[model samples]
Target: MIKRKWSILFLLGLSFASVCQAGGDIDALYSRIAQKDIQALNELKALAKDNNAQALAELGFIYEYGVSVSVDIPQAIKYYEQACDLDGDYGCFNAAYFYEYGIGTQKDITQAKTLAKQLREKINLSNINLDKKVSER
Candidate 1:
């Protein structure tokens, strides 16, 4: 358990570092997203196609909240899972949330637990405590 925890932390830390390195691009993307820019959305889609973790997470957010498109929970989950697979902490947390509540997919506590565990050791942006949520379930 301890070894797994350390590894998750290590992986998330690496992801966080890369995000920090690209902080300017992320901010610009969010700025465009906030303005409902279709170009930015397209850029995100392009980035997601390359398996960009941050872009995948952003696309998940856009789909989940209907920023410029209709709400598509399943699509959001798909993007979030992709980001999570790349060790994006935010993606892991959000995907875990959906799994925990069965929002887009069937309720799967085990899957939720697995996803949440990936974020438990990281300082994530979501601020939604997946560990607490999973424990309460």
Candidate 2:
């Protein structure tokens, strides 16, 4: 029984460590972005492979605004859509804006409205979670 308990605790600790490591990687990626390090682009691409929403959203921004690369509106829209599907609220808003204005996509007010609503809900939920954390502290 003691061995089983120890094994369960070890597995839990391993999972927590992995989660922390992923968070650290994300933080490092943001730090690289702040420095405009070209290596950050590669890191972002790698993270996107795991469907990291922040990485996808950042990639969309980079492509959309021609940050250190040629402007590619279609590519930006694709990344934004992927990020939005992953529940990245900023990406959802960007995708919705593109759909609404027919920028890099066909004008679809209905789709834009749907995405806008989803983004709003996500923001609300995030705020609530933040509030809970603050209160707990």
Candidate 3:
């Protein structure tokens, strides 16, 4: 039990360190996106094509808000759908919101409700797992 606890802690610490190291790159990408840099957008698009959920979500936001491309709710929704299919929670949330409000797609309260429930369950499960881990320690 002690060895398992230490192993978990080590893995968590390593993951956290990697996240911290990637923060700078993520910030740079966001900055480029905010500036509407075409090169950065192209790179993101390529990444999205490779099934990068974060890239897809960012592209969805760009299209939704007309940051660089003209505002196209349908396109945004499509990107969000792709991201959600890749298990991106933010994408799922945005897609659900759009469905609920009929922003881009037809109003589908049932679908939205289902998605929201799924998201809730996923979050709950994640929390439960974290709690169990903590308790084990």
List the candidates' TM-scores in order.
Answer: 0.73, 0.66, 0.71
Worst 10 residues of 3 by lDDT: 128-137
Candidate 3 wrongly placed segments (more than 4 Å): 1-15, 19-24, 125-137
The list of candidate 1 runs beyond 4 A from truth reads 1-21, 121-135
Model 3: lDDT of residue 103 = 85
Report lDDT (Cα) of residue 12, candidate 3. 100
**Residue lDDT tens for model 3, 14-64:** 999976765455456767978978887787788789897777888899899
State in Å the error of residue 108, model 3: 1.4
Local accuracy of candidate 2 as per-residue lDDT tens digits, 1-137: 99999999999999999878876887777667656788887888899888988788888988898877678998998898888899898898898788777888887777777777778687775543322222232
Candidate 1 backbone collisions, by pair: none
| Whole-model alpha-carbon lDDT for candidate 2 | 0.80
**What does candidate 1's lDDT look like per residue over 1-137, in tens digits?**
99999999999999999778776676688789879898888877888898888889988998999987899999999999999998788899899999989998999899999888788656543666666668687
Off by over 4 Å in 2: 1-38, 125-137
Scored against the true structure, residue 87 in model 3 reaches a CA lDDT of 78
Q: Pairs clashing in candidate 2?
A: none
**Global lDDT for candidate 1?**
0.86
